[model samples]
Target chain A: MATVVAVIASTHHPFYYRASTATGEDRPPFADEWVRKILTFRETLTRADPDVLVMVGSDHFHQLWLDNMPQFLIGKAPFYDANWYNEEREFGLPRMLLRGQEDLSGHLLREGLDAGFDLAFSNELRIDHSITCPIITLRPEADLPIVPIYTNIFAPPLPQPKRFVQLGRTIRELVESWPSDLRVAIVGTGHLSLELGGPRQFGPHGPDPEFDRRAVEWIANGDLDGCLAEVTLDSLHAPGNATHGFMDFMLMMGVAGAGARADHVDTLDLFHTMEAYFTWYPNGAPTA
Target chain B: MSRYLLNKFLYTVDRDAELVERYRDDPRGTVAWWEAERANAVLNCHTGEASTWLRFTDAEREALANHDHVALFSLGAHPFLTLTLFIAMFERDHAEPLGFQKQYAVRLAHFDLPYPDIAT
Candidate 1:
C-alpha cells in the first residue's frame, strides 16, 4: 500500500513567480523575504520525500469554461502542460510540463466513483498556476509524477464546502489503500479572503484581514467544525467575493484529518492576498 | 442577460493576444464582431457545431463595449474574468504599478454585498 506521507495546503498567488524572480530595481521590497519563506516551506516537502503528489487546485476559466464546467474533475493524462498565454502575459509564469501518475489517477477515478463522487475525468488537461505554484515553491525539481484534482471554486452553483471536505477525506482513504509502495503527498492550494476585481481588490492586504486571521486558526488547528459552521456559500461572500476558494483548504483539512494540527505552518501578508503554506505528516515527522 | 456570454467574451478575448489588443484598441468593434461571429461557437469543438442561442442582452453588450467593469459586476459577470481582461487592456496605460487595478477597485467601490449573484 502507498504511504500517505504528507498533506499540504497553500495559496496560489500568481504573482509569486514574478515577484520571487524579479531582481534589482524591479524587485518588490518584500520579494527577498517571500523567497526565503518559500525556501523554508519547500524544505517541508523535501523532507517528506514523497514519490508522487496528488495536487488539488481550481481552474480559473483557463481550460474549463462556462460552456461545460465540471464541479470536480481529475486529470488522468500521462502528462499535463501547465500555465497559459495570459498567465505569461500577466504574471510572467513560464510554461511547464508535468508527468502524471496514471495508475493512481485510474485508482482514484474508480474508487472515487464507487465512493459516490461522480468525479469527472479529463484525458488531456492543461493545468494552470493553481497546481504549478506549489510545484514552484515546494518541489522546484518538478520531478515527481502528479494526479491533478480540480475543484470548481471559481464557478458559482459550486459544490458545498462540506462536500469538498468529504472529497478530501475520501482521497485520503483511497490513497492509503492504493496498491503501491511509493510514498504520496496530497497538496492543495486555495485563497484566504481574497477579493479580486471587486471594490476591495488590490488592497494593502487581503480584503478581509479579520477573516484571514480566523481562517488561519481554523486550518492550523484543523477546526473544520468551526470553519464549516461559519462558512456557507452565502457567508463566504462577506469575507470577499472570491473566498469560496477556501473550500479547497477545507478539503485539505479533511485530508489532514479533524483535530490534527499541522506540523508545519507559515504565512506571508502580501498585497492583494495572503500567502499561506501548511504541511502535515500523517504518520510522523520525517527524519531529515 | 447571459452573464455566461459576457464571460465568454472576456475569456475568448483574453486568451488570444491579437484579440486582447483588438478589443483594447476597439472595444465596440470587438464586442460587435464577437456577438455575431463567436458568441454561440462552442469552444473546443468544430465551429460548424455552434449553438443558435447565447446572445448578450443590449445592456450586457453596452457594458462590455464601454469596458464598464462596474456595470459588469452589477450584471454578475465573473469578477476575475473582468479584472484580468481589463487589466490586460488598460493596466499598461497607468504609469505606476497596480495603478490601474487600484483605480478599477475605486470605480466599483459603490457596490455593496449580496453582490448581484454570480451563480450563472
Candidate 2:
C-alpha cells in the first residue's frame, strides 16, 4: 500500500535560484528579504522526505511547441538527471536529488493508465529550471527519487479546471495502488499572485505581495475550492502574473482527497515574486 | 475537434514510405510539411471522440516530412501523443478508409536542467 505523506506546491519562478546569493551575486532586482522566503521553503521540504515524489509541473518550449503537441504526459525515464546546473557558471544543484528510479516511475504510469488517465509515455527527458528550482529548494541534498507528471495548462486547448481536478483524484488511487512500501509526497510548483513581467518590476508595488497575501490566507483557512473558483488566466494575468503552474498544486490537492479542503502551509512575498506554499493531509485509512 | 482513426496516419506512412523517407532527410522541408498537415487536421476536426486518425493529403504529406522532434514536442497535445505510429493491416480492411489500425509509442522531452547528459 502507499500513503501520501505530504503534498506541496510553490512558485517555479526562474529568479528563485538565479537571484539567490548561494547560486551567485547576480541577484534579481528585488529587496533582500526574498532570500529568507526561499530559504524557509528549502528547510520545510528537506524535513519531509517522502519515498516517491509525484511532481506535477508544466513544460515550456524546452520540449514541444505549436507544430506538434502532447496534452497530458507521464515520464518514466530510468535515469532522469536534473539538468539545471551550468558548470561554466559554477552552479551547484540542491541536496536531496536521487538519480534513477525507473521501477517506481513505470508502475505509476501503468497504474495511471489503468485508472483511465491516458498518460503519454517517454524514454529520454531533461528537467527544466522551473521544475528544478523547487527540487533544489526542498531537498538541498537532492536525494528524493521523483516521478514527474506534466499538465498542459500552459499549452493551448488545455484541460479545463474541472477535468484537471478529476485527473488529480485519479492520481490518489494510483499512488495508493503502488505495491511498494514507499512514502509518497506530491509537490505542485507555481505561483499564487504574481504575474510574469508586470509594470511593477522593481520595488514592492507588484502582484507578488497582494497575490501572496491572498493565497496564504486561503491556504491557512483550508479553502481550496474557494481559491480555485476565483483564480483564472485573466484573474492572474495569463502567463504574465500567474504562470498556470499553480494548476499543478491544485490538482495535487484533489489527488490527496483534500479537494477544496487543503490546509495552507506558508506564503512568502519576495520582490517581484509571490512564493506560496500549500500542503494537504488526506483523511481516510492512511496507506502507510 | 474532428476525430479520425490513427490508421489514417499509418496508411500514409505505408503507402508513401518513399516520399516520407526523402522528407526525413530534408529537415527544413519536413517541418514545414508537418505544420501544414497538423493545422488542417486540427482546424478541420469536428468529431467529439477522444482520439482520431489523421491522413495527410498530398500537400500535407510533404509537410509531415519536414517535422522535427523539437517541433513535435512544442505542440504539447498530449495523453495521445505517440511518436511511433505502427501500421496494422487486415485482409479486406486494407482497402477501406478505416481499414488500418494504429498504435503510438510515447516520447518525452528532457527537462531543462543543468545536467551534463542534456548538453550538446
Clashing pairs for predicted structure model 1, backbone only: none
Off by over 4 Å in 2: A22-32, A84-98, A197-205, A208-212, A232-242, A259-264, A281-288, B1-120
Candidate 1 lDDT over residue span B1-120, tens digit each? 798888889899999999999999899998999999998887988767888978989899999999888999999999999999999999999999999999999988898887887878
| Candidate 1 Cα outliers beyond 4 Å, as residue runs | none
Q: What is the lDDT of residue B94 in candidate 2?
A: 55
C-alpha lDDT score of every prediction, in listed order = 0.93, 0.52
**In model 2, what lDDT does residue A231 have?**
70
lDDT of each residue in A1-288, candidate 1, tens digit only: 999999999999888888898989999999999999999999899899899999999999999988789999999999999999999999999999999999999999999999999999999999999999999989988999999999999998999999999999999999999999999999999999989899999999998999999999999999999999999988899989999999999999999999999999999999889889899999999997
For model 2, state the Cα shift of residue A148 in Å.
Answer: 1.0
What is the docking quality class of candidate 1? high
What would the per-residue lDDT of candidate 2 be over residues B1-120, giving only the tens digit for each residue? 111222233223323445445444564564455434532354223643322444444443433344433332233212112122212112123553212211111222242211111100
TM, every model:
0.99, 0.60
Q: Which 10 residues in a row give candidate 2 chain A its minimum summed lDDT?
A: A84-93
Worst 10 residues of 1 chain A by lDDT: A13-22
